[model samples]
Target chain A: MKLTIQNLTYSINDTVIVSDVGLNIKKGEFVGLIGPNGCGKSTLLKNIYRVLSPDAGSIYLDETDIRTMKSKELARKMSVMIQENNVEFDMNVLDMVLLGRYAHKKMLGNMTPEDYEIARKALEEVGMAEYEERSFLSLSGGEKQRILIARVLAQQTDFIILDEPTNHLDIQYQFQIMDILKSQDATVFSSVHDLNIAGYYCDRIIVMKKGRIIHCGAPEEVLTSQIIDELYHIRSEIRENKYTGRKQVYYIPNSANISTCAVTENL
Target chain B: MAAAGFAAMIAAMLLGSVGIQPDWVVKILANHLSRHNIFSPEWEANKEAIIWTLRAPRVVMAYVTGAGLSLCGILMQALTKNSLADPYVLGISSGASSGAVAVICYGWFRFAGAYHIMFGATLGAILAIVIAMKVSSVSNKVTATQLVLAGIAVQAMFSAITNAILYSSTTTSDKLRSAMHWMVGSLASASWNTTVYVLIISLVCTVIIRLFHTELDVLMLGDDTASTLGINLRQVKIGVIVLCTALTGSIVSIGGVIGFVGLLVPHITRSIVGSAHKRLIPASVLTGGFFVVICDMLARILAAPEELPIGVITSFFGAPFFLFLIRKSRNSFGGKNG
Candidate 1:
């Protein structure tokens, strides 16, 4: 599924949050959205996922206007994984995942054997099949993320939108989740805080600042030290790691500049 | 649970101040069901009248009120995505109480006679819900927290008005007693007409709610996720609030403000049957009906000829039992800390 956003604008309380942002993501492309803390990445994604209506412009999934589509119809084509983690009611993993099939269900439809099969298969894909009956609230943060990923897999949409899916996980779990997402056949759009992880996985990166798209390109083209310094207001160097040959960012602390100057004489 | 509710209903009919044998109670019911005249001549006239005409309607009304209120609780909890939400959480009861009190104190709708109180209660409940919705919504989005706070504000305002009416009234003692009993909730005024009306409304609402069982489950995931899953959050919320208001208003109109039954029964049913609405709805209806019948029975028998208010009996027993259940399932009810 191809996603096209054209001049999308959103505002809250008459203050613009997302302003005239546009992008095109081809099918099966692993696209990453990167920006500073309040750069409207999440808001843009929310607009795409139909959580909030855009104040201006249009979004198209393939040739169809998204605004004209019904929620279930759109859900059948796209699935979203948001950062909200609160579960006010106690539900088990299987039950939670089974809810992903809601789009395919009738008003009072019963879950058939096929539905359970799909849910179990999704859990298996996320490597949480063993925890199907476990309470959702009892799971650790990483485990819960995996189960939520499993739920999106059960949704079985052609496109998936993830808002900081790896926000709070450890390195190993973060890589595990990214790896799983990287291997999926669907078109993936994700906003990631860690630039290194984004550099490692994204086929293309779109950078935003103040609700506008500043740059969009491959990792090596858009992740320059100058852009990073200006976007995040920090001094940084982008160096390729000898071990993995991926671009790694190293931030220079205020004192590190003095140390570098002191060592210059020896060099 | 359904069988227990049926048994409790029969027991309620049999154990009033004018006690009748279980056999005779069953025979009268059976005769009524079969439309036969066989047992009509043999049974004592007063016992038959007491069992069939009086206690039967009251017991049936108790069942209808319980089922309807519990179903409302489940819908409210799902709508707000809060386990603590009940039928009265949205200020319906307080609004109804205020209306009923105004009628009782000032003869506001004296021309309606028997239906004046029901009219006031239904109007008040609907008005309260509309105001709450209007106050809480911004940009056409109704959040659970905002809705709850709005309900609280509405409840406080309506309660103050009710108090003002109660304090300023110079009515006779009889009217005061009636108003007080109604506020505390009682089945003393149950009649066949009210019973039939409550039963029909409850049955229709339950069936309609059952159809949206899956939607209710999706709603618990919150608005964003529900919308992403193909649910129109706004439409579902409006539909649920309207249906819940109708069910709750009807219950309040017929049976005053019965507290705790709606709050306690759904939580108990959720724990036993898990959170699937398909099972939860039926289980709640049965358990709620059983609970109210048993509590009404205790209210009748505990004080004998002078019946206790059913609300007092429920709150007294319900509060302790709910505490115990929460203790037992500490992790389930432990919110975010769990």
Candidate 2:
């Protein structure tokens, strides 16, 4: 249940994208990774998921080395949901979700009714059960991302990794997706693009800058104004939300004059 | 679909230059299958001979060639993750053609005798695709546009080799003429021997591909996602490539370079059955069979005894469809949002 990374480094053409990173994620922890664009958050996740091998160091799920196990065995424990934009082919939503059961099936296995039941429930969890019969390509961007999340849910792994799960979603959808991920029982490790979203849902935040981990702790400790300025070089006002009781941030542009210091307070 | 395939087969056999009776076609098939003369020969000896020997093997070849080419299309599309990929578009067909032509002109693989063309065709197909794939790939993956462009390059080169061998054979004989017929893709030389060989290969390939239906489905999700989903990426890809190349080689050996069936049939069936290979593969196989048989029948009856090459008939239909698909795909890909 514990995922450990020891001294991991990954490089492409000798230009390191993930460098000497180390961490341990305990069972059932909601961990968020935050970094500026191209700061190697995705690359670090890829290394953890075995999509890319590190030039040094190793990862273990509990006592087991991930490198020694077959991909099927690894998939049984860890599921990954990277941004899936272009499918290029049309298929029924249910069938697409059912692909998550691939690691569990035998070579000549058929899609049993039980499998369909699991897929249906997963879709329902994402509020996409009614769209199961629809062509996957016909769905909107938010709907497609939901279906992909449903696919990950159907995978039924105890641990999951998501890379920028809501990069382009509208604010309405951004909260809905975060709500769904938070509601899950799995140990969730994700790269989060929106700082406010991460602050609201994530139990702990890991901040990366220039291919290295700069800070890691509770969101309140890690997402401070100083760290935000240091990481992205932007001025930001931070406060605890009165409603949700979590940290919330509002940015201050140098050109814009602030009438009041508290942007959220007025609302 | 099965009924349609049976109907198409009957029509293909009955509508040839020799007007054979429908009853005779069935009885002839029965006799061949049972390996006994179950029905008395009420028809002329020529009619029975035409049904059992000439037309039966030709019609079977038509179906096998159709099914095999379509399967290759599905595999290529899956392999490159591009809808436009096929044996013809990827230059695998032209590679097989060049190999087959070399065998015919120089009587190469004389040691292997009857099955030499298939081996040569397979070897040529492997070589052409290796070169095409090597050229098309950027980093570790092949993009849709680069694959098609590389395919065109491979196609042009292999076609040149085939033509060069055809033109440079100093002796003028039936061997050269038969090679010419095959070069353009005709079932005129299809016999019981080659038909059995190709039929076996098609059936085996179909079964193998069927086993990977789930893997192929995952593959459509993209390479990175599929592997994380537990698909042994290397194993599935190698399996698909080997099966596609072998089937393409055998198909060329029998039917020469029949184009567009491989490109057109899978797309058509995908539209009807959706993109899951479990449904799409079987549907494409049957639909492809029906398509080729109808086309073969047309090749026979189109200009009477002077048979047009089956490729000529298929390209007449397939070329327009390919252009239409290009425009359609381009439209979807044109905007940043598509």
Worst ten-residue run, lDDT, model 1 chain A? Answer: A258-267
Model 1 RMSD to the real structure? 3.7
lDDT of 1 by residue, B199-283 (tens): 8878999999998888998998888899998998878988887787777766777677787677789988887888878889999
TM-score of each: 0.90, 0.95
| Candidate 1 wrongly placed segments (more than 4 Å) | A255-267, B38-41, B97-120, B133-152, B160-171, B317-338
Q: What is the lDDT of residue B32 in candidate 1?
A: 76
Q: Name the weakest run of 10 consecutive residues (lDDT summed) in model 1 chain B.
A: B329-338
Local distance difference test values of all predictions, in order: 0.83, 0.88
Tell me the deviation in Å of residue B108 in model 1: 9.6
Off by over 4 Å in 2: A257-267, B104-113, B170-179, B331-338
Candidate 2: the clashing residue pairs are none
**Per-residue accuracy of model 1 over A176-214 as CA lDDT, tens digit each:** 999999989999999999999999999999999999999
TM-score of chain A of each: 0.95, 0.95
